[model samples]
Target: MSAGDISLVAGTAGAEVVAVAYRSTTHGEVHATVNGGHFALWFPGDELRDGATEGVQLEATFRDGSTATAVLTLT
Candidate 1:
């Protein structure tokens, strides 16, 4: 799946989500950062491994002196 098809759905605005980051838990250790909205990640000459799980962590700082995080697992 391309990064463009990946998305994070969060609640209404309390914090402005600036970006989403991803890291692969396999060899080559690929990392990606995408815009807060829908986006795509493409690695030329390498297909995203099947069954290669990725850990996704989100960082958000709220206007109310609060912080939030969302963790996601991708297969």
Candidate 2:
């Protein structure tokens, strides 16, 4: 598997990325985190690993209980 970092800029600073996961139909959550909002989680090459790739969905839950979602890609 290709190990890499998945960097995310939480629009709301200090919200604390409570969770970084990949979820999809017939699949479950793979966790990651944030350290100072950069170089956080190492993307676990597998789509269902601790990270995701193109077309996979990324769901981020914040400390405030709010959440955000995005498709995994490098573009």
Candidate 3:
């Protein structure tokens, strides 16, 4: 089993982020979001790779109108 968390800082207003998303190389993508200054995301066993691994990618957009990404790997 694997688990992890991500923290983001929303520097200004209109700062929004997609905190977590799930997808497979074969399938498409699943979208999730969080508002405000910070968020925590978790991925359970089998969610990352059909019981092989667990991980999450977090996407963020700043109020300055810039975008960024952070990745967390769990084991």
Best by lDDT: 2
- Candidate 1 CA-lDDT value: 0.41
The TM-score obtained by model 3 is: 0.37
lDDT per residue (tens digit) for residues 3-75 in model 2: 5633332222244776666553333454655556532333333334433343445677778888988765433
lDDT to native, each model = 0.41, 0.50, 0.43
How many residue pairs clash (N, CA or C atoms closer than 3 angstroms) in each of the candidate models, in the order given?
5, 0, 1
Candidate 2 regions exceeding 4 Å error are 1-16, 24-27, 39-53
Model 1 RMSD, rounded to 1 decimal: 7.2
TM-score of each prediction: 0.29, 0.48, 0.37
> Per TM-score, what order, best first?
2, 3, 1
**Consecutive 10-residue window with the lowest summed lDDT within model 1:** 6-15
Q: After superposition, how far is residue 2 of candidate 2 from its true place, in Å?
A: 12
Once superposed on the true structure, which residue ranges of model 1 sit more than 4 Å away at CA?
1-52, 73-75
Choose 2 or 3, whichever is better by lDDT.
2
